[model samples]
Target: MSTAALITLVRSGGNQLRRRVLLSSRLLQDDRQVTSTCNSSTSEPRCSRFDPDGSGRPATWDSFGIWDNRIDEPILLPPSIKYGKPIPKISLENVGCASQIGKRKENEDRFDFAQLTDEVLYFAVYDGHGGPAAADFCHTHMEKCITDLLPKEKNLETVLTLAFLAIDKAFSSHARLSADATLLTSGTTATVALLRDGIELVVASVGDSRAILCRKGKPMKLTIDHTPERKDEKERIKKCGGFVAWNSLGQPHVNGRLAMTRSIGDLDLKTSGVIAEPETKRIKLHHADDSFLVLTTDGINFMVNSQEICDFVNQCHDPNEAAHAVTEQAIQYGTEDNSTAVVVPFGAWGKYKNSEINFSFSRSFTSSGRWA
Candidate 1:
């Protein structure tokens, strides 16, 4: 068979198998969109858009189209924190899944913390490659990593460096204890940011996942994807027993299995010297910057650019709405993988705050409202 034909067959089979798994998993909610069709003869439910164009054969059955069954439900906003100075309102929405097998269904893609006192907002997105374990691990531990590094008299640069190193160490330790190869095999890309004192923002990342800062109606990428096809990445991969291959798009990949040069976990791949160290960057937050931060997996990036997402978000006043819109757009564009997003608006702090406070005093008061 021709290479194209072979590839199509493989994809079709994979899709069919995935559809069966999703239907049987029973994890999807009825509200979620699922593709379906009616059989001409039996009048029963069949595959919708599951057939390839002009193939006259079922391309494959896939539930939720190219998206994943796992979705990130937004955390309820506290009334007190919903409208306050420095962090008026923050919201998050995520959808998508990892490429098949060896990890949790959904990769951890968003994390945010709004602190009114410090006027600091922390947000992050992790894009897992091999599995969800590494991504989820980062999601749960990132806050701890930052807190540990920040309170120790370290500068933002130093703190970000140490935090990423610590994250890798933590993942390695956990994987070792589990004695499960899968844990070690799973890896993820991560990008994080901290909006500090409403004056500056710090960002850091590793792997292909991206972080973009939309400022003044323009998108500025904060992190670089450490793909193995780059000159430096190729040199490193070569030294580590891996070779880069050029795809039809002329993009390079490591052993055609992975793309990024650095990532968290992937113990087996790390043996060749592909460490899990992250590259970090920082920027100042400005008043003229009607900016927002967007962090997402490659799945979303595959179909839409950072500027495109930012433009869409800019149209919507609410971050939650913006996130949903971006996800929907990704689905419409035919991203055949899990899609997730987190949109954080800049310069909109102070809208979410508590209107009342309760206090008590032990001393008795006179009729004149004087304490006695």
Candidate 2:
């Protein structure tokens, strides 16, 4: 058989299997509904099949306990196919971002989020150092580079990897065209994520920027910092004939310059083991347990831990408020750096309410409201 024909046949079989699983879930839900109905009187309303409490009302999208009544948004496709019930769509309208200059002379952080394709959503955070040129370039071309590779690559992981390398090469060409030697030194931390079919999440990151997920009121870090502080990263740098040195603040730097082992630019440091290659991760999202994806630059990450950020978000009404709250709080805590945060609500957003969170302003912040 031809390759295209075989690919079509495989997809057809996958669809059939999905349909079978969905049908089974529906049958199970129908049986529960019947039992719940039979157990109650005609005047009493039936509770939701997924409802933890026996509330006497039919389950709406709100039954997931994710959304606020103010939004009243309806569920989109894909996710419903699996649950045999409605789950609210993860929309661009629900994505939120906040960026602040803080004590920096220039705000060097950049972030973007949007629907990249019909089935994929894109989100990224770039923390620029030395200059904003690299971050700015990435902010403009990263999405396009990823979309260009999506048609050729079936796996999202490969797509992200190729996109990162492509964008890094593109930045080098751009820097050369600008005729600015300083642009070569400009580098940025890139943490990019793609959500496909509302089920698969793929994240690729370099440098110290991070992508974190909130699942069932807890924090799950999706990316790790690619810094000389990591033993493997340090060893890799040493193998490349590079050395690690500590700054006055005791932060390790590769070759006594760049703090990270990987980045998007910094052409001068490329030979010293500061590479553009990113560490990538892919995960299957569980809508019922996964609440949102939060992307942050080291500015906020250095000041606020992932659990603290997650709890703060859980206390907010929506993604927009959550993003602003986290960045603002980082500044309030005396971070002398640019602070930026992007919050993308998933199927389980707002499921954990304010009452569920035990956050204290004094607990995370120091007595002088400074970074401790």
Best by lDDT: 2
Off by over 4 Å in 2: 1-71, 82-87, 354-372
Pairing residues by index, what is the TM-score of model 1? 0.63
- Collision count of model 2: 0
Q: Give me the candidate number with maximum TM-score.
A: 2
For model 2, state the Cα shift of residue 76 in Å: 2.9
lDDT of 2 by residue, 1-372 (tens): 234422332233223345335434644675587766676666655444444355643333343333333333444444445534334556788898999998789999999987888888999999999899999999999988988898999899899889889988999998988878899899999999998876779999999999999988889999999988799999989988899999998988888889899999998888877888888999887766788899999888887889889989888988899999999888766687899999988867777655655545674566233535
Q: What is each predicted model's overall lDDT from 0 to 1?
A: 0.59, 0.80
Estimated TM-score per prediction?
0.63, 0.81
RMSD of 1: 25.8
Q: Against the true structure, candidate 2 has what lDDT?
A: 0.80
User: Which digits, one per residue and each the tens of the lDDT, describe model 1 over residues 175-218?
Assistant: 99996778977888877777655445788788877788776667
